[model samples]
Target chain A: MAAVGTPLNRTLVRVRKPFSEDRTTAVVATTLSVLALTYPLIDRALNLGALDDLFPIVVYILLALGLNIVVGFAGLLDLGYAAFFAIGAYTVAILTSPSSPVASWLPFELNFWAALILAFFTAAIFGVILGAPTLRLRGDYLAIVTLGFGEIVPIVFRNAVGLTKGDQGLNAIAQPNIFGYELNSSTLWGWWYLLMLVGLLIIFMARRLRDSRLGRAWMAMREDEIAAASMGIDLVKTKLFAFALGASFSGLAGVLFASRYSFANPSQFEFSTSVLLLSMVILGGLGNIWGVIVGGLLLGVFDRILSARATGWIQGLGDATGIELLEKVNLRDSRVGFFGLTLVLMMLLRPEGLLPNAQRKRELEAQATPEGEVRVDETLYDKRGEPL
Target chain B: MQDLIQALLTGLALGSVFALIALGYTLVYGIIELINFAHGDLFMLTSFAALTVLEAFAIGRGSPLGTKVGALFLALLVAMLFGAVVNVLIERLAYRRLRNAPRLTPLISAIGMSFILIQIGQYWKGSRPLDVPRVINRLDLLGPLDIGVRFFLRDLILILVTIPILLGLLYVVNRTRIGKAMRATAQDRDASALMGIDINRTIAFAFLLGGALAGAAGVMYGQYTLTTDYQRGFETGLKAFTAAVLGGIGNLNGAVLGGLLIGIIQAMSERFLQNGSAWANAVIFAILITILVFRPSGLLGEQTPDKA
Candidate 1:
């Protein structure tokens, strides 16, 4: 039976590879770069303010990439990635605040570049602190513990009245400046577009890392920890690196976020934010860099479009119908309902995601059974073909 | 000394509620190895049910003691039924289909379910805290050493009532045929199924039992706290989950111990942390980190065969 299935399975696998060369990677990168460069121009020409919409997408893309390193490559489930984002935002807030000492020491002022670098280190340090004890545990345990950390961080920031101003939030955070030219001009789209360029650079680096020895080791650990360890992978060091590197991306995104908003609040770093970011990674397809980018863009665009128009759309429908019941529908609150529904639908229909990672696509396809039968039986078989 | 005693008592009372909630987590996890994140929301719903029922009766309108007691029992039964139904529905809709999906999928579904419950409650209750009626009379007692223990008669009664009931639960789980089947399913679902156990039904029963316990805890919590809100479940759920982890995820006895420990720690941390009691979460998480570092499997959690 096994011999009979081998040729058919190989044929099926062969038909699935769409773009299979360095040429494809080059084409993707070039197209993305061209699009990134022309985005602001397109926004201005179309009079659509697309740059404003694209800003958060860029942030999310960076974040999803960061999370991809840990959750995707390293197979570490981190539900608290927002804590690192918070660290980045807070670091910039504290250092660049008018009352802070860093303001006096800097030649010009605390700007985006400095903040971005500092945010990386600050968030990375916290990542190390969180990872030190919990990294030894298995996946689910790490997820729960990280969740605890995520919940606690925001609450601590909110309640530490003396330091964090107890929910009023830190405001008037300094914006980015290039050389002597201030990037804080009304045309903030320029700075955001530049950030997207920087995001592309980070993506490039990530792609490189994905194909590197460290990336291979992380993937090996994710697939089989004992096997990876036996093959001379230092579990502690590799896990910490994954955590630290993953955190650094969020940290970078955070600094950019504070600069973009010119404000930082504890409320912004809630579990929902973490979930949203996780959704992006999952939606794109875990462990796939390109998938993460696509997922981020899709989620960011969807959220923006829905939030801006959902209320109006509902009100318009109410007006058209002349029904008072429809008028009372608060689309803002309904957004969460939609989010829940989307998550459930996506998990059920597209568990491997819209753009699954290469390995995940293969695995999901292999485990895909007929619609009625439970998929567990195929996946549950041990080495001896007996159920555990 | 007086403050310490009061804090300890307060902690114990609070811990009892946590223990009750934690039992739901432990029980569900034991059977299915899945954390029912929506359990806290179910608890919140139960509290709302109790509040609504109590308010319906003239108990809030100064009805007599007998009327109030009758209302409370009726509310408890209704809430328990609601919990059981909700659990069954959740199993059928969200968890049943994902039985073989990656672990993360079910967990995420649980989170999604939690948001749905919270949103539905918010929509129903209008996002404000519902005031629980002050129907139970307070009774103070002084012990032998002039201990001056001011125990609320209602709370004391609840603790006394819950203890035997939980013990009865323990007895059922350990001594009954159904209980043996439950354990067998937990140990090996396939093996249990081979031996003629209906795996899905057993899991549903586990969820129903867990939800019922959570329902009871919700009513008790509402009575103690004097208010119930949609957002209450998130924090309460986190704390209970932490307790379940501390005691051992799948161990009933561990959950009880963990809950009490967390309650006491939370109370003491609030008392001692000088910056206006806001460091409660920080302290609790610190304790959690310490425990995870020292004992990742938790105090009573036995090592299971690695499925991952």
Candidate 2:
């Protein structure tokens, strides 16, 4: 949205060249979109049963992409990103679910689509409310504050039995309707097509934003706050916008998650889920949209399918070999451990992530002088926290 | 008045445990300025180790007092050593290399380390809460003195064990060469390195002491509460972290004071407020958020400019 030659737009032309000039990237993106659109139908025709987990994984990717806006793009480490996810789902459930206690007080059950829109705004508002105060603090303190908020949200939801029905949770939520047909978890094909379109649109929007003036501001702030401020970037506004935007994306995913499952529960928004999403983002590559998607898909498939199958195979082998220790082995119990290992190993060996952003990869790999000073290449970038 | 006094006393005993754990957090945070997220889980592992040791000795309610004491001492030693060793290992394996990297790198790694420790605890002890055998008799110690209040022997034991350790820690930090090195490192790592102080060893020593404190807290908590679980680490770790922050993170006396205050608040709420037990965590988290926002330096911390 920035006009040409404004302070933030100096490097826009330079940054847009590489991606736009690459024909292969465009072709690969198009191919992936087409495949994503058709996968559900193919799975159904073959009775592959991949649809069951694929839908949730899509939602997860959507979430990771949203998180990328904050942790990756904006450079804010949010340990409680799931709190926004919870808020989004709970908002929709409380509004549209017949089982929700709010039904007694409210005159009508809101339409699913209307509730979804409301949930997005609700999550965004909450994001600002949380970010406004905490973002003023330093990075790590903001992390702990967000973590505190994340831990508190579920507790409040769980304890507020009158509204959320306590541990039993809100079920039988209204499903999104297309014409006369209602879409639920069983209508996997419909949900898949809808989510695929949403995901694609979001991916497109994310790309556009990445090239926009605001995105540059976020990157500027993330790289160096004081310098970004000196360059006339509003640090508070940029950080808050990123935080709110990231939250809204998670909210969108939450609405889809609740609508598909037809249930909303506190347990679904645990700290573990947040960490799992973080792992996906890190494993795929931070700050890269496609990388996040790949990371999300890889880990999601592993968690939902491969891990279980591998465990069963191991157990079967143990039975055949009569090895008692192998028979007792349970991979599910070690799932979190695996994620933890991914995080530690990734940070240690490849902090730039698997599919690092071009700029990020360069920054991480930038050569250091013998005196231990990083020599920033002035040809590619300036000290204003911009690419060029 | 009677209930209030009882709550206060119980809170003091509970606070002592939190203080121990909180020391570990404050110590590590003080030296490295990195939140050792795995410290709480380290405490949990130590508790499990202690449990296993006690189980091996078959020390239970039926055991003789002298034998029980001896077994308890052995369990304590094992737990401390286990905690210290494991903590040092985590620092070496996960955190050591990332010392010069960005702040978030080691933090994320610490979180991973925490999850791994939780997994280990789960595999060792199963997921459910295990009932810890009550080795000390629950005899009322305050009744003999006609104090018109009930203070159990367990409470006395908790205080007796914790206070001395706290004093010993204070003495070491104030009087020992290594402790001075830790303070020097905390003040400025690069400068300390330039001065020829072994930064790695000082950092490792901080972890060792912190881990020992966590180990001591774990055994005391498991024994006092009569239960231990894998998930206990996250909850207790958060509370202890809160204590550390409340008392001015990186401040020893601050952590102890914060711990006792939090314990008292929890006890008062759980006893006085309706459904307070369920809401206690929420209250603590609220306090953490509020304090960090309003007084980021904490009650006892110096007002360092926000390190952007």
Candidate 3:
């Protein structure tokens, strides 16, 4: 596509040399982002009020960024991550919702912005509390405990009828008012702009964290915990940081989610929610920041927006074509099955995921050959609760 | 005292079902050390298998007692066979490749398999728990004793299924050549291989036996609870795994003991505490965390170093 010997082409190539060895891909990505940002504006201007659909996608991506820190970077598989998200949402709901038990008990209502900030710390503290004990446990045991926590937390929230209103959930959660100007969920542009701003900030933070010293420590810890510990990486502190920091972002995402939907329910925070988040991290390719984005967006959009519509579209096509099979198939019930299939297929076929981490890629390559002929590998936890 | 007796009986029934499932976990963990996450779902699916078999025979409450019992025995056989095959297939297909990879890879794969199994259960059985038509007469077997405690045919069903299966498993593990091979392989895989034992075959055998027991537990579980659901596995599986760990993960007898203890605790907690069944799962899980914290080796666990 480059015009050979053209002056403009030579100038563009010279300008792009510092960014990367290849420039077209970067240029395309940049152009796409710019276009994406403007499309919302265009939609608004054209009287289309569909900007609210993006709120969930943006919020989920934020949560993915948080989970990526713990699972992707620290190498801890947190199966109960949605508990933190639940805590975040529930914390906001309890504090700000007029019908909430806390509101009735406390006799004082907290502002949305204040509650939003508080939710982050609240969720982070919960993460640290969970991480403190379970992080000491490794591999499968750790995973099981987290899974238990994930189940137990939602059940507690659901059963604590006096506070969470049982299964009915909290409604009319206070929406955020920045500088006395109310942010409305119906006004698509305001919500979209705010979501995008938070999205960019978290993205920037994730990129920075990836390159920082903590990131290296996480990598070292993930690769070989004994080696990292011997290297004086302060394993406990490093891990807690990963858990707390990861949880903090999930809290923010929850605030946005609650404010947009204006509801918080115990049913929203199930064990499957944690699984969905974990799948996103794995699907994106562990240890790669950009891949998490791609994975989260791919999953979030498909699950939230496209799944039912696509199924209906196919059904419509079948009805038109008089094909009996396609019209009767319900995609909703098979969502979890699809998730399960995705996990199995991805692990077996592409464990490195859509984006591959260089070190992990190397690790996968090394494992490509047979490690042994016919002997069992130590796949169980030893006395120290570490995988042998 | 009467409540205690009733709870005691209930505990035994629950414990027996748990023991059967826990045996599968312990056997596989003993041999391969991989936590088969899908084991629970596999167990759950076995109920559906049993359901399908019963339906095929048109076995329902109206069926004569003789026919009902016969049909159930046949269904249990089919369920066990299906469980064994599914467990073996999962290992061969999903886990065999990552046998030597870092421990997490296979664990995730197992989790994936579990999700698929759970979803399949939902699809097969629908999202809700299905009522198992009570073919077994729920006549109180011990009502004549008049000790103020009632025991039904359903409670006795646990014993009928568990005792035979447990005895059969003990015979197989203690007396069979494959059992010896499994023991040798668990002790030292490399040396076992050097001694001409087929490691993969031994491991697959362990999975088959484990899966069969889990399948048996599913049938027993359905009969005792009088309901079977797609999601039943997660709850039962969690408790059974806890039982496995509590009893010392690799120890066969330990799993049984642990299962009994958890069953007693569940029944006692639900009985003695006011409205306790709602908090039963949380209580059991709490015990698991406490046990893991204080005694990671579990009650009867022997601290064996890496088998390599």
Candidate 4:
């Protein structure tokens, strides 16, 4: 087993704190720069009532960040992230809604901030619960098991009518309120955007964690668990922390999602959402924060733009072709086709991802091995693709 | 007593189907250590293919024996061909390219292929569940003990037919030249290649055999359930995969035993456990987790040098 800072230590480490003098200045400058650059588009979109278009992007960005911790930094494939999102949303729903038991327990009604805290903890506890027992399994087995958990959670939420209202979903979930002021109606977007800003702050904190000793431990475990353990990295605790923290963000995202939508439903948290989140991590380049943000925004906006315009595009093509069957093409269904195609193309063209971490990029580049040349050793190309 | 007997019978029948599907998962995982996420979708496609072939036979309106026999043979052939072609294409297009990539890369590709297959199926058959025409006769015999023991003769015959055939497959896998080559390839791909075995051909053969079994399972499942849905394979696939893992993923006989155990467990849980139907999935996962924790190599799994 290699020591933490040995020759094989290829883990990328950002030494500066995420919100340190340099990073803060960079963030502020970038924000100002971006705002200045997109001023015209922002103005036009806002003028046209397209501000809501940014909401899903914000939500997805947060989801992507949360998932990156588990799947990217920690190298744990989680297919049930939406379950945590569902949990957070349902937590908020159960606490703030007029129908909730939480309202009855309090002297006065608890607001969204309080509910948000509760939701985060509720989802986090569930995350820990789920992660505790299953974190010991091997990687692919972990993925399948998590996939099962993802499938099972929603079904439970949907069928447990006494608690979750089943498929009917919890409606009339209250929006967030800060002290005397209430964020309601169209104004709700302001609060949601603020919440997303806070989520970005959390992402910054997560970025810090990614560079910490804990982060190094996670990377080690991901590279080789046995080796990591041999080097005295506490496997159990480190894995639990990854699970817990990854799930905490998912829970937080759920709170924002619930409050933004003002509804909590099981249908919203499906297996496909998990796939989308995973794709975001992959597309953005795992272990790269900025890449994940870009990936999330691209996929989120792509989904919205494509779904809205796909029918029109299909209709135009159908008209040109004089084919009635083509006219019936539903862009909504075709979105999945687009996602599939994108993944395939991405794998073929840039397997390392759009903004891959330096180390991951190098690893992928190393595997290409100049196309036609065959490595002589038969054991060299095992499942891990490493020479034995 | 009657309920117990009925449950056992149903469990065995369902277990047979699970075992068949699981064989596909185990075989592929055995050979290449790939999970073949698209496998369930393959199973679903094969079911539709069976339906298409059976429909062409006009078996729904014919004599039971002739229709059953004809539909059985035609459906199996068509389904097997579909499975083989699809599996081969999947290997070539999605998996083969990722041979040198990380484990996660191929898994993601499998997922992408799954979506593609499902979309294609939806486009062809529409998203709605299609009813498979019943062409087999059901036989119910009164027990000598006067305890009612109702049985579907088709299920009994299906199991009786499938078990022997599956056992024959086991024999071939353990004894035949191709089978030995497959084992060698699975144990060490590069070594087998160096020894003049075509690694790609061995993988294709594995996929071919796995696909054929999935096709057979689809035929049996269609006959038993009388309906096939695009999404039907998802849950069944997960369960069968669980069985494969439970019995030791790359071990052939282990998959068979695991499938039967899972099938019986599922049936028993649904019949006896509280809120059984609702919790059945969770129970299966709980069992999987337990197995993983206690015996990661699975019941009959041997430790391979290459780690996935």
Candidate 5:
């Protein structure tokens, strides 16, 4: 930052690399998208049960991709991301569900289509509200404040039985409509397809932003806020945008989640869920979008499908080996421990994260000396009560 | 006046407990600038450790006063030692290598450590809240004549256990060589190393002392609340952390002040206001956010330009 020439360029451009450099990457991405799109159709034809499982994981990947913008690109550690997710879902529920007071109070309740648009903006507004007060604090302080915000939102929702219906939660969310046609809810492929398209578009937009001046400003702030500020980067605007955009993505996923489940409950979005999303981004590799997608997919599948199957496998092993310990221990029950371990091991072994961005990798691995020391003059305020 | 006085005393009792844990957070943060996220969980484990030791000794209210106090003393000592060792182990295993790498690395690892300790607590004790063994009797110490409120022996005992530890922490920090090394390192690690201070050892000792404080707090917490759960650390530790920040993180006396103030506020809110029980955390957090936004330095914290 002190030196003005060639500010280290790290683009979130993994998907768009020339075919010559990464033929496999492009091909695999194409094949995956095509497969993801067509899988539900195949599920319909074969009557497969596994396709139903993809819904949650796909939505989570979308969430992780959104979070990646904040933690990965902007270097803001948002411990309370589930707050935005909650905001999104609750917005949709209140707007669309007939039982909701808002719906009845209005001349007519908005449809699912209208609520989705409202959810995005409402989540973004909440994102700003949460982000505004916290911009000046450093990493851990920012994190803790976000954590508090995260805790407060759900608690408020839970307590406000008058508004949120308390623990009963809002139910009977209408099946989503698409261009005047009612989509089939029993067969979830249509929703899955919609979510997949949204995820792809966000990822694409994120990639473009990575190369844009605003993304560079974010990188500047993330790399060193003081230096970035010295270089005239608007720290407030950049951080807020990161929070706003990151939150909007989570809101998108929340709407999808509420619609599909036909219910919006506070319990569904909790600290553990936030931790799960964060682990996905951190383990996948911070700052690398493709890596985040990979991280989300691996962990999602593990958490959803493999973890349950692993429990059975552990039981089978115990039965075969006659080891009482394996039978006594349940991996699913201990999955939180697994997540905790993953975070610690990942940070220790590779602080750069799994599949780190090229620039983020260089910076993390570079043993970059601590940014120019904070001095008395640079302190936010002074003893005489004058601002520094 | 009666309600106010009652709230005041209750807040102070709770504050003393918070002060102990907040001291640990301040100590670690002052030296390493790493918020030991696991400190709260470490305190949780120490309570379980104390319980297991007490169980092994079969000491209870039924025993003679000396044996009862002695067994409880022994358990406290064991918990202190266990907490100190485990804290150092966390530092040595997870943090020592990342000393110079990056700030975020150790922090992420610390979070990971918190989760691990929480799970261990869950597995050791069941997930449900366990009723803490009443080692200390619950007779009201402050009167036959009700002053419109009761200050139980439990509150007095809480003060008895906590105050001495606070005094000891002050003595160690103000008077001892390890304490001096810690101060020097906190001021400037590289400079302290140049001046022949064993920086690593100093940092390790900081964790040890921090762990000891956390362990001591854990026992008091269990005794005061009469229940322990795995998630106890998440709530208590977070409150303590808020205290540390409120007191001006890295400022020793500030932590004590912050803890007392927070304890009082929580007590007052819980007792005096409608729906205060549910709103206490939200209110406290609102204060935290307000402080960070309006006055990041906190009530007693000085602007330390030299430190990161």
Candidate 6:
């Protein structure tokens, strides 16, 4: 009874390194957490009216982290990631919104906290349903299927007027409450702190997953699918887990988004949203958690703050110079163009991204020269992961 | 039955235009495995070019038949040239360097290019839809023949333009030396390079050919729909890409067949299904997912050896 075989031992493996082991990661994480915690105070002191506008962007960063798992870790290209976001938002909207069809059909409205939990599972189920059939296909084909699914989901939401309210969408979703205080749009500090916590939690979880056994399997599969499978990895299971897990994160984001906005609309989730999230992931550096956070923040600031300000500056120049052409110029609606340019230029000039993952940077640099030549010696070593 | 036949005729006309665009996708994909996401936006830009030409000539419905015909022909050639030049430039500047990069690299670049082109389109035409003056006669060709179903002159024109382009494309790919080089390069880029084929030139030729087709399709689409908008590219491109995928992505004949089938389905759905206009796109997307999952090879596509 005291020692049956091997005395009951709880500790099997050490998952995390001591803080001193990785000074850079530790310092960066601490600095970011401190800054995030103080951001509302900073915004208030500076009189920057950006606090409200910047709220949803935290959710976007969460989304990019989720996408990183599938695209970066598993090496699956998902062009329809926004569909999962939409599904999650709709789940929360339907369960908690007073105007939802559920209000008429069911006797009780689900609690916001409970609905948030439900949204994650609902979106994950949808992810499994979509991923099961297409996971076995080639990478590009999987992209097309996901793109189709993205297009179809919004259409379903728009057409099912009874369930989704068609184009009008669901309104008056319940906001999160604790004790005597409620978290809504007006409580900017409340939401700012809440989202910051959620973001930190997700980052912690994503990092842990990245360093776990499954993470290694994902990297192996990404490098060589056949070799990974031959090494006894279950390809479909590994892929499906990444897909569903990624989807659940988006679902969580969707709930936060709907609750904060107090509404869910079909127009909010579109192909452009998917592309925007992708650019953030790529811009930050795929597969790197910190890189994605920085990338998402830069883009969010640019999208929410700088883009509009740039238009104003352009008009101001035009007014100062009395130049009609300059006056008429507007970059306010040119977000798509800017994102597009970012994608192309980044791919062409710095495909490894702004904060390149060490291994990916090595793989990319080793693959090509300025003249697009595959140096014979480099190719041999890069392919089989050998240092000659 | 009459409605069905009429729908079929309209579908065929629409299908012909889709086929032209799908051919461009198929040809480019056949040679280079990129999806050319900007191809649809290029089509949009070409239609704007055609509109500029028509407006420059001041050609309208009231113009004499001879003037109308001359202006349209000029527009077609100009649009084709414009499309070909831009497409080649895109290949040289945006895509060539990424040829040997990861497969996703080029695809993402193409998506970026699509967005850029779309922005250009918005700047050129503004956000509102523009009306294309009816330069062709609206008389029904099948009326005098008493076929019991109406077939408009526009439908005839689409068919007439399409058949020649299809045949000419077939001849070029099957019989021409440049075509031979294209096929060779597609089979093996390094092997073709060893054989002294100028790989870049051959690829440029494919883009030129594809762009020309897109230009022609643009002109026909403008006249058929009588309206063009910057956003038209996204919708039309999605449908044409679906057609390309449905037919077996790299096969020329398969693209045409797929285009026609998609057109028929769209038209029939619009005519028969409740709220069909709104639901039509959803149906196509559903079909696309189903096909990719169940049969990635498509109707006529051979099992691509690259899947492994």
Off by over 4 Å in 2: A1-31, A366-372, A376-388, B144-149
Worst-scoring 10-residue span by lDDT in model 2 chain A: A17-26
- lDDT of each residue in A99-119, candidate 5, tens digit only: 788878889758887888899
Off by over 4 Å in 1: A1-35, A100-111, A365-388, B142-149
- Give the C-alpha miss distance for residue A179 in model 5, angstroms: 3.0
DockQ, all models: 0.45, 0.68, 0.54, 0.43, 0.48, 0.67
- What's the distance in Å from true for residue A214, model 3? 1.4
Q: By lDDT, who's the top model here?
A: 2
Model 4 TM-score on a 0 to 1 scale: 0.89
Model 4: residues >4 Å from true position, as ranges? A1-48, A101-108, A320-325, A367-388, B61-64, B141-146, B303-308
lDDT of 2 by residue, B1-308 (tens): 88899889989999899999999999999999999999989999999988998888787778998988998898889999999999999999999988877778889999899999999899888999998888789899888888677899998899899999999999989899989999999998889999999999999999999998998998899889989999899999999999999999999999999998888878888888789999988998899999999998889998886555
Ordered from best to worst TM-score, the candidate numbers read 2, 6, 5, 3, 1, 4
Q: Name the top TM-score candidate.
A: 2
* Candidate 3, B1-308: lDDT as tens digits: 88988888899889999999999999998888888889999999998998888777787767887889888898889999999999999999999888876677888888889989998898787888788767678788777987888888887877877888888888888899988999999887889999999999999999999999988888888888878989889889989999999999989999999999999999999998766887888888888877766676788998655322
- Model 3, position A298, has a per-residue lDDT of 81
lDDT of 2 by residue, A229-300 (tens): 999998888989998999999999999999889999999998988999999999988888887888898888
Clash counts for the predictions, in order: 0, 0, 0, 1, 0, 0
**Over the stretch B1-308, how does candidate 5's per-residue lDDT look in tens digits?**
88888998999899988998999899999998998888989999998988887777776668777877887788889999999999999999888888877677788788888989988998998889887777878788667886778798888888888888888888999899989999999988888999999988999999999899888888888888878888889788988988999999999899999999999999999988778888898888788878877777888888756322
Once fitted onto the true fold, the runs of candidate 5 whose alpha carbons sit more than 4 angstroms away are A1-28, A41-48, A368-388, B58-63, B306-308
Tens digits of per-residue lDDT for model 4, A282-380: 887877777777787678777876576768897889989999987887867765656666676677678767766755665556556654675432222
Checking candidate 6 for backbone clashes, the offending pairs are none
Which 10 successive residues of model 4 chain B have the least lDDT summed?
B137-146
C-alpha RMSD values across all candidates: 5.2, 4.0, 7.5, 5.9, 7.3, 5.8
Q: lDDT, candidate 6, residue A244? A: 96
> In model 6, which regions exceed 4 Å deviation?
A1-28, A366-388, B144-148
Q: Is candidate 1 or candidate 2 better by DockQ?
A: 2
Query: Which candidate tops DockQ?
Result: 2
Cα deviation in Å at residue A3, candidate 6? Answer: 42
What's the CA error at residue B87 for candidate 5, in Å? 0.6
